[model samples]
Target chain A: MSIWEYANPKKFMQTSGLLLPWVTGLAAIALVVGLIWGFFFTPADYRQGATVKIIFLHVPAALMAINGWLMMLVASLIWLIRRHHVSALSAKAAAPIGMTMTLIALVTGAIWGQPMWGTWWAWDPRLTSFMILFLFYLGYIALWHAIEDPDTAADLTSVLCMVGSVFAILSRYAVLFWNQGLHQGASLSMDKTQHISNVFWFPLIVCMGGFVLLFVALLLLRTRTEIRARRLQALLLRERMA
Target chain B: MLPELGKYAATVLGAYALAILLIVGLVVLSLRQATRMRDRLRDVEERVKE
Candidate 1:
């Protein structure tokens, strides 16, 4: 079937049903492999010791946290302009996953920081902006629950998603913008003039790719659930009217 | 049990355990939620058919 065919809710659900197990299996495998490879095989940083190993989890989750929000922002914009119900639901579905990733990043970050930076928390721009991004996630999830009208909720939340994206962008680049930071400079940046060793960089790329797939699997499952919920709600409302 | 865990290793192990626990919790909760929604929708649909 063409990619567009899955745009229909029933078709989407069918596709998800087939895809879910494979995605789930892949996620479990990749996560296990990545963690094992990171902890045991990868050499410890000479300076940071075993503690720098947190990068395997911290970096990937942090990257996903930002990218997930960007996905929601784009989906929200599409939904608003095109009035696509699926697009709105996709945005809503992504919120919790994004929020979880953000929290993962924050906690792992603190753990990494305590040993290295000699503190559990700091008001550095990178950390501060991430905290704000977490708040935006909370606000988005709360808005979804608070509004009784789905259409209204979608519209308002989409607008908020657009407005709030600035902070998500800031969270990514805050280190570069300012001179002061305990945080190491970006290991990966748009300007690829500086290159990292293949040993570290290669696995990092694999983990990142694994994370992206994991996110896709999660978002698709969540979106399917959301569509089912709206369908049930519609059915109940119709029954009441009858 | 590793020897060094008495001091700094405790924090490191604790942090990893906490992260793994939280991730497991999140995945379980998400799966439960998705299942509930799907089942509820199916139930409602069956009722309408009746």
Candidate 2:
């Protein structure tokens, strides 16, 4: 059976329905454990002090915010190239989740920065690009509602996703292209020297895993709902025609 | 037991609380919406079939 078989809506519903509970359960456990460990057990950072704890939430949410958009970009490309309805619907399903992730990161970042940077807001390149990313999400959602034709909306949103990718890249790498602002360089990297110290690393990784699983479970649930809506629309159209 | 979070205790706790609120809220809302959508779809399908 090809992987694309799961793209069939019925197959998808069955598979994702089975998988959702397990994924959600794992996410809950991991998130709870990671946050507890990071907040209670981990020592305060020497440089930043107690507020360093916010990284547990802020970093993971930030990472998901970017990665979620990247996922939509890929799904959009798949939909455009392959004409897979499920792929398009999956992209639609992911937007709100991605938007929420972006908001969480922005708010948490501001809170963390207030104590560390001594200011709540700045026109830093990273911050500005993230705000742009948020706008892209809102515009994408708006496009979906503005267009009544599902296929046309999918086409337009697919194009929007492609365009938004450039801004997402700018958002992610703005720290590198411009001078680094209040945001720190990526501490987590494939390079061994750049990996975060173990005290913070373990729970951070766990928390990130939890966030990813949460994203997956939610995406599946939302996608299933979208598919059902589409089916209902089709049936109604048929009834009208008959 | 809550550990001493120094002067930033409120801020730290607030951040966590907000994250929890948002994440849990999303999960609950999404699940409820899905269930409702499923029910509505079933009803429409039945009507369309009839």
Candidate 3:
């Protein structure tokens, strides 16, 4: 059947409920194995030492933080175009998870930066753009809570998501835009010359996988909750009318 | 039991602790909200049936 069929809330709920347990279990396994491998099994960097371990969390979280917004951006567009309630609620469900990922990335980056850069904070292009991304997430979430009408809130936030996507794109490419940033180039890149060594790369890939699965699991759970809440509101309204 | 993190022990540990705390907090909040919503919807559905 066409993918749009799942856009129906009941079908969405049925599919997600079946998928959630498997996704959650895999996420847990990948995260545990990856973190344990990175923290305890891997060798320390000659220059960065144990602080290098922080990369395991920082990079994955940073990746998810940006990707989560992109996911919302796509969901928001679908809602705007298709007028699907599931799409709007999915976007709403993703915001807090994205916010948390951004927070983890920023905090871990700062902690890692202290020793490597001899500073806890910087206005460097990459860091600055990421900061703006974090603020956009805050604004997106706040807008949802502030508006009482779901459709209106979804409409406004979808527009906001489109506006904020510019900054999200900036956050990802700021290093290429301005070369003077204290932040280094990408940790994982498609370019073979720029790629991290396999010693650290393998576990990192696993951690990234874990983070992706975790985001999906959380998104499904939260979206289901939002759907249920919407149904409850509808039922109550019907009761009042009756 | 643990790798020797050298002088960065506090730094590395602190980052892990904070990240884990935030993730766990998010998970707990999500699960709690899901349960509450599920229960409330079930109750409303039951009352409507009655």
Q: What lDDT tens digits, residue by residue, belong to model 1 across residues A48-100? A: 76665667778888999999999999899878887878889999999998998
Q: Mind giving the per-residue lDDT tens digits that candidate 2 earns over A156-219?
A: 9999999998878888898887885777777588887788788999999999998998899899
**What shift in Å separates residue A149 of candidate 2 from its native position after superposition?**
0.4
User: Model 1: per-residue lDDT, tens digit, B1-50?
Assistant: 23222234655566667667767777788789889997898888889999
Local lDDT at A8 for model 3: 99
CAPRI verdict on model 3? Answer: high
> Candidate 2 has which clashing residue pairs, if any?
none
List, residue by residue over B1-50, the lDDT tens digit for candidate 2: 98778999978988888888888888898899899999999998888767
TM-score of each: 0.92, 0.97, 0.99
- What ranking emerges by DockQ with the best candidate at the front? 3, 2, 1
TM-score of chain B of 1: 0.80
**What docking tier does model 2 reach?**
medium
- Any runs in candidate 1 off by more than 4 Å, and if so which? A1-5, A189-196, B1-8
Which one wins on DockQ?
3
